[model samples]
Target chain A: MISPELQAHLQSVIPSSSRAALRTSVLPALLTGVARVASTLRAAQHVSLAGTANAFGDDQLNVDVAAEKDIRAALAACGTVVTASSEEDPVEKPVVHQDGITKGESQETYTLAFDPLDGSSIIAPNWSVGAIFGVWDGESALHQDPKTRQVVSILGVFGPRTTAIVAVRTDDAPPACFEVGFGDQGKQTWELMRAHVQLSRPPFKARYFAPANLRSAGEDARYMALVTHYISERYNLRYSGGLVPDVAHALTKGHGVYVNPVTAGSRAKLRKLYELFPVALVVECAGGRAVDPATGEDLLARPLEEWDERAGLVCGTAEEVDLVKEKLLG
Target chain B: MISPELQAHLQSVIPSSSRAALRTSVLPALLTGVARVASTLRAAQHVSLAGTANAFGDDQLNVDVAAEKDIRAALAACGTVVTASSEEDPVEKPVVHQDGITKGESQETYTLAFDPLDGSSIIAPNWSVGAIFGVWDGESALHQDPKTRQVVSILGVFGPRTTAIVAVRTDDAPPACFEVGFGDQGKQTWELMRAHVQLSRPPFKARYFAPANLRSAGEDARYMALVTHYISERYNLRYSGGLVPDVAHALTKGHGVYVNPVTAGSRAKLRKLYELFPVALVVECAGGRAVDPATGEDLLARPLEEWDERAGLVCGTAEEVDLVKEKLLG
Candidate 1:
């Protein structure tokens, strides 16, 4: 549960721009809804109970449906949202506004696409996993199918005109802060944080925790244990077992690192990373950092017109993030 | 293919001592037989294709059979054999002179127990793997089975007086020399090796390759690639993909490092590191080193009686091994 002080801080940090309003007001609720749907999907598959479960197969479809519904509902709640389309249903058609919600006339517009889960296949072997996304404005859907989505356009969003954001969760402590970055500026932010923080110190051990599944409580527990053990042995770092949860936790914690390094073959496995940004500007104002590792630039700095081609991200205190960038991109 | 010069060098370098004769006359045949049996088992599984076979499973059984047959045959050929017992069929009672194949008057006696395929399960994942063995001068196998077999008084060989040798094979280069260590003078040998090698170079890269199966030729290729990449990138080092192959290669090459870090669970995983003396000896002999990271002591110097309870090993050119030992054990 989020402390009242932290919740207020989150609410106060939201930007006043049109993008920020939608992100601050509607993104969290949408993510919560998506999490619920994902949970339902896992329950249906009996993955949350005792028995061997194939983590892939139909569970993927369930995540897709849940992601679509959450994004649509969130968009509908924001009057400025003009016809939202996602990679899941890429017809450029307006989202079905359920609950009789109507969109208000506003120049502000955006499109979102995502992989609700990444590295899901590794769940059986208990490897790291997470979610990913790509977002843009003036476009309803980026690709015809989620399977065909490209990260190149996502990279485009890092250009001077665009804004991008990502939220992560794991099974550590909760009410975490989300990281935000824009263009090359993100790299500077990361470096600053690194210089200020002694990365090798205790409670700041370098650990990675990517949960493959988010819905099943049982799997969640296992994911938590894995993360806890890894962190406890090293630096006492914690995660929330979900992309948003983990990202949020990182933002609030002020130390540690979060990454979503998806190789080419694993793009479609997760989507939360892709969706949270367009609607969650609160992460930015909370003194956190996030950016795509490939460009060593901010995730939110690029315009929505070009956000499909970008690689995955690293989000944390500036210094730790810079270390990753140096290792991967530098 | 081994160059003629290298082959000649190997043949000449092998000691002419009774034990050296045993290794020269027995180890190669055992390795060859194990290879053949492994191939046959792979064929049985219909996994003989170039790229699709698993290398660790039932192939282990075949390797064991082949190794046992070759070792026994070699001992018998030397005319210093009375009876033999193997770890696999310990209850069969020592095979007495029969069918005129063996001279009943020959009082020479030796016993051998082997894990023909160590880390065999790593074959499926295309990782490094190998074989190990212990030789004793008695009639029975080292560890007895729970179920009583047809023969009872087969002369059990107990305690640390027995000599042990391990043969490792990896996919890097040809098999080199064996690591030889004696129970009484373990630490002395370790220190000599530590004084000779250079270990500190930055940008060090470490990789673990444990294949799940070993019978598939295709799996061998993958294992080879991993070994080559890791060694080349880290230290321009090369090792055989199997235990004997690796130990032999390291012994002669006189560079690089070999380590088996403790995994999350399962103490049984450390057996291969515990059993080999010559591998450590050769590593030290060639200006390299070997130590158990958990204990910070030279593995060869440690008493074998206490090895079953130890964790894992870290070995390399003396300097590198020492660095790891200092970080982990210190």
Candidate 2:
């Protein structure tokens, strides 16, 4: 059953000034792309062979590469998107129009930045993985700045129930949060499960994530001790080697912490534009906080000099994230 | 697509001597029940309310209790199952037939022991949880001896795809393994994906699971040290708070190890008949080993005297499990 409020969410992502015009635009195409990609990923169990190393130097499962192609095809066929940027592609790829408009000539309304298939390395284990995309309103033919320009951010988790969590920030309104159950195969059909949901405050249990082993080589002892401290405090370890599902888990539960810390001699693990920024916006929109451990500022406020620039992520319930900033990083 | 071999596996679980009779009888009903139950669980993301505590004293998600009812209703409709047993129920519940078979009058062919919603705790977090069942060929009514009297064991993982991993031992031949994509929702629609798959040997990278916090109080220092040693050795950690998916990962990857060890106060974490025996049968069928870490005996060989009898599980690649026995327990 697609929730009625989910359509409201899809509609809200567009600026109210252009609501009617954009209503039949990029959102429908984006949702279609996500659903198709999810449907394609369902075949991962049948395809077990690890294909090759991805652009990020992680082992790309055959399913991952296929999912990227499926999403790209779905998005391009939408005709509203001008260009697609992904961690899988070294350079931004132009989406061909069904009409005879060339890439350089056709006026497009939106540019998409996405991680077509997140956490490809863990596909073999059958762990939950997801696809994430952010949409920027096309003022220019291409959005020169991605981090500050995105009008909508989405995290899609293709787990037991395929879900799309959307954060829509129109210039007039504070960002709104909604979760839509996609993959049920209804065009423009979405049921909104929650509205104006925010992370729960203190006295809730905390769950956290650290992608790489803190005790692994070159990781600082102090960082390891901090994680050990979190463990000692009875924080549940919630890392699934997938950012989309982990963040979605936090969003739904309304509590728990998730972190990808920068270690000594290494930059932060997740890409700023493709992953961290979009998720940070969602977290912030939900009244939760995403912060950089180094400067102790909101991750959303940080400048992204490069699309691949990375940042340490500490995000979750307002209190838990506050606790992390105050007690550990302080 | 449901693998063709998977259908053969469902049929093969019935003893060849009575193959035709049994195939037309209870097994199809049972598979239908499992598939329906899995399909029901696919909606868990929408049904996020926490339910009453389960028999294990763990917090039960609403889906957990509902899943038990869904499976029970499906099985009862089949007319072949006499009684359904699960961790959720305080005692074995007799299946109520649509034709109104009284508890005493109806002669049932199979007694099922199951964890209807294994890893129920992980459901809220949207992590992979599973449905596990062991079928006992009924000579009498409800089978009192659970450990030894099982003819078939099936593990269903509800991840991106709803997969049923089956191991059928018909006395004369070695147990056979097959994976069926049951959620595709069509009868006799499964296509064969794999046959006689085996666990990879020592040179294969290892993934391990120990559900408890290694740094927690009452956990033995020796065990902690051993797990830390394994981590240093670069073994991937694969615990998702779900046994079926974790073990399924080992079977599919053809390598890795999973253990629910006996902590200081705890006897062992996993229940004998419900989880350990069914999984052990599947692992051993795949040429891996599932052992009682104490006496160095196979878990399937041990008698389960009580419904909640706990046993330490150490199962994976033969060489890797052997390493656990030699280096840690021994």
Candidate 3:
């Protein structure tokens, strides 16, 4: 788990430019901090494992529990959260102690529905996987039905002001830091990366890393190494293997590009994130970018949810993300 | 160019199995023979120190001219051809001699269209590529406009049949062979090749030589080396970049798999080949199998042209091709 001080530091870094000032608010920034910390912890655990089986159902539950606890604590500290509803808690199957010492009942204003480990199937094969969440204001209806409750939160969160972020944090830090540019600047960056390698002729080759089990530190390190190799501007090669942890490694390391191309089959999840300013704010704070490739517009500025929605995405950098969108939409 | 004797040797060595006899005929076999020779000659010319470029607009044109010349010469000698249409003269373009000599003109009865190079772009990127063709009976209604005339011969001979071939020639010759397994077998072959340094790994990967270019002794040698590295049972790798040249390479070497994933887009080409017996017959005679992955059915029964048709294909050894179909279709 990330220390509270570090979480506070992360919150402070939310970009203040633009209407993002809303995202920089104490509430959203705190949520972003909590989410980042959860991801970091999950990544550490995944790297310690050897194979993908280590990341199945129960394993996923454990990671989600840890993340939920951290997030809840963070929000509680701020006192902005009047009540919280989590997918992790069972509505009917309440916890009971043999000693008749029951734990506190569920209490929260906002509800959260999350898939803590999406694309987990790719773990054994070294593919990308990620965490996804939807948040809605506490007063939304459907808070009565357990099954329908998760859907309601997701639908409620689908609108402009919603944010999505994918981070690629790596263990290896380069000697010098660089920023990725958009549009023409982005193309120039690619050319520059290629040129630098061609001139130096470093014995570099593109590599892929996908950590399946974030509970294992060993697997996490391996995944981190792979991201480092891919994002090194000198090498100019990056890989996501289809998961958030793998992508996050690349973003945090500030090396290569990280992209998630929206597919026609998976737009529901993207729409759900547009209702809140948390995820997008955190990603931008980390010096990355997120958007829906189909529109080439700020994803947060669009409707949060639509039945005909196509796809949603987030990337480590704006340029890299845009390139992926161009390929898919073109 | 392969001598007439060598061509005869190749034709005689082809199997006469029931499956082989049912799928192809004399005309297509002769065309295949001509194609082999033309490809060899082109490869040889390219490799020679006195490199020369033919006036043809593309590799496809070059192959057409070479194949037509060989086929005409052979047919004239054997008195087997009553009439034929070369792709270069689809409308039987009048051959006019400008010299001060007596003028003569002849009309062609049979129409042919040939794509001597398919997936040619693969070569530049060091990927696989091949050739294609379609042949039909010339008895169809003729159009006054040359461009409007239906080239039945070319249209009839396109698709998967152009890709299959028998592994063995005659008792005295070696057999053509290819594998059926999926990525596992491919990876194993890749590993073996890399371990022996017989084939270089990617980043500075091996070059892709067009079959036409591979015909030259030097280019042929390099191509053979690559083929040997791939087809060795211990390696268990089959290479089928596309039709025509790829199949020809397998036919020449006596072994290699031909893979055509049943994608949603390739139905039209498959249907056209069903009209002509040449492409299908040649592959069967050469000792290979042709199969549709969707139904695990023999693909040589007929051609499929509908845009919505869906099926994958693998043409080579019966056992190997079947295995591939199972893996992909499943």
Candidate 4:
């Protein structure tokens, strides 16, 4: 059910060896699975509870559980995913073989880590939420540099419209990003919204900022100064309390910087493999930068080892990211 | 075309004298028109512009212009809307009569003021944006107490779902809020999602904060203290750079406070007619409080005589708003 354009796209950016598997099962399963998450959220929002809290984060709202189940099921059915992890489960699990038709362990085989639902804390308010996926070319997500092994990153945004920003990498060409949308009456079809998406490009002076962990400002004076600097210089504020939407805003504007600085008082909470890696890959592929705020090194340079590995991030348009590192990290 | 439940709702909240008009024209036109805004935004997000700033603001994106035309046209066709205004075109203008049948200049003849597309600055990133409308029962939105004259307030949220938080105030009963979704294969019909929506109620300590104009903290010490207090107390952050979504989040969470303070250094930018008043009515109806950040008076108590009346607002759960006032204003 994929369009020819998307078909051609997967062929070019994904390694030639993995193209058939991607076309046959991987991408279809991924997109369709995320679409189901959208429907589940829409349906969940409808069930009203008067005098009840409007939020879903504290106890893993049913929507979170449903998103994991739906996306996990979609991937497991592909039979190409040999191993997978989720923000919810975290433990690497062998996706149960359902169809009994499994692919041999090869470079074409994939490993995945996903935050089935990100920013659930804000969902009760019906603010936008998202799902993050990082896909590796081989069976395990460990002991490998994501810059070379991680082939795909997809961020599915749950907002007024259901959309996903897909980033792909190939040794042959510069990594690129694409925007796809879920629509059509049945809410099942995935249509290409834009191809070759990129962050705000050259001659770019910083324009927008998504500053997370503002609470850290109270703990760290430099953090507070950084916040003031942005205002004094007049950078547009776009913090949405969600990693995917915040970075996605930069990917959408092709300009902007996102900084989640780690202070001794406010340790960084974004998990590397599930949360940060996928988003970092996507932003980098879109002609932006993603780095550890502490060292300002490439975020992808780090291997996925610890299941709960967390890091502070400064990512987005390369120039703005540089400014963030100089002002805060330096 | 209206559902029995909605029809019944209108019959009760709207005066008996205006019931037939609301049922026949007002609500239908308003809902359908906002649905069009959702569609326009979705469509606009698709027309990708690479290498361009990922934003539709500054000079007014095409989406903003298109939204005003669509909603204004829909309202004008009802022939019952005598005067209308928009954040885009702030001057009050007569919605030219489109239909031959016009309602008499009675209480049923409505007045509307809308921010056709609120938070357009953030829309470029595919983040959620919204429409805010205040509907009065008579010809002018001026010289009237929005607490009473503003009979209906609709907050249209454009996100993974196209939904609205509608608040109605009637002399006969307590004000109440409702949530509705736009769906079905056609994206034309409105279905009840939840009824009698309210903010988090009794024994509630605030859980969320939408801090707008945080840049003001640089200018005012109290503003900085307020941000620190919220952080120290660990108020969940729910800001999305949009007034409607920020306030809607509070309404949905059933508990939260949103504060946009005006310091000697930073003047208020939210207009009374298009943004503040409508949201105030809805929050109040939902058992929340919306007050001027400085004076701590009922926002609706002020008359809407000025077209561009800007006010600093502290709204949401009553107790949290009080905390904000005490910490900063006092």
Error of 2 at B310 (Å): 3.5
Model 3 CA lDDT for position A298: 52
TM-score of each: 0.35, 0.85, 0.28, 0.86
Clashes of 4: 12
Selected candidate, larger lDDT, 1 vs 2: 2
RMSD of candidate 4 to the truth, in angstroms, is: 4.4
* lDDT, ranked from best to worst: 4, 2, 1, 3
Q: Which is the better candidate, 2 or 4, if ranked by lDDT?
A: 4
Off by over 4 Å in 3: A1-330, B1-113, B123-240, B252-255, B264-271, B274-279, B303-312
Q: Candidate 4, what DockQ? A: 0.44
Interface RMSD of each: 27.1, 3.0, 25.3, 2.6
RMSD of every candidate to native, in Å, equals 21.6, 4.2, 23.7, 4.4
Q: What tens digits encode model 3's per-residue C-alpha lDDT throughout A53-115?
A: 321223443444555455444444332233343434312122122243223222333334344
Give DockQ per model, in order.
0.01, 0.38, 0.01, 0.44
- lDDT by residue (B163-275, candidate 1, tens digit) is 12232222222323332211111121110111222233334343222211112212233323332333233232222234443443333233445655543332324442224
Candidate 1: which stretches are off by over 4 Å?
A1-330, B1-7, B15-24, B44-100, B103-110, B126-128, B134-254, B258-269, B272-274, B302-311
- State iRMS for model 4: 2.6
**Shift of residue B73 alpha carbon in model 3, Å:** 10
The top-ranked prediction according to TM-score is: 4
lDDT of 1 by residue, A1-330 (tens): 223443443444333354453444344434433333332332221112223222232344333454456546555555444444444443345545546555544555544454444323222211122334443444454422321221111111111011122332212212222322211211211110111111232344333322222122122333234323333343322322334434533443345566554433334233322543421332333444566644667765554443334345567666666665665555
A1-94, model 2: which lDDT tens digit per residue?
A: 3345665555555546554434455666667777777677665446654567767677666777787788777676566577778878745666
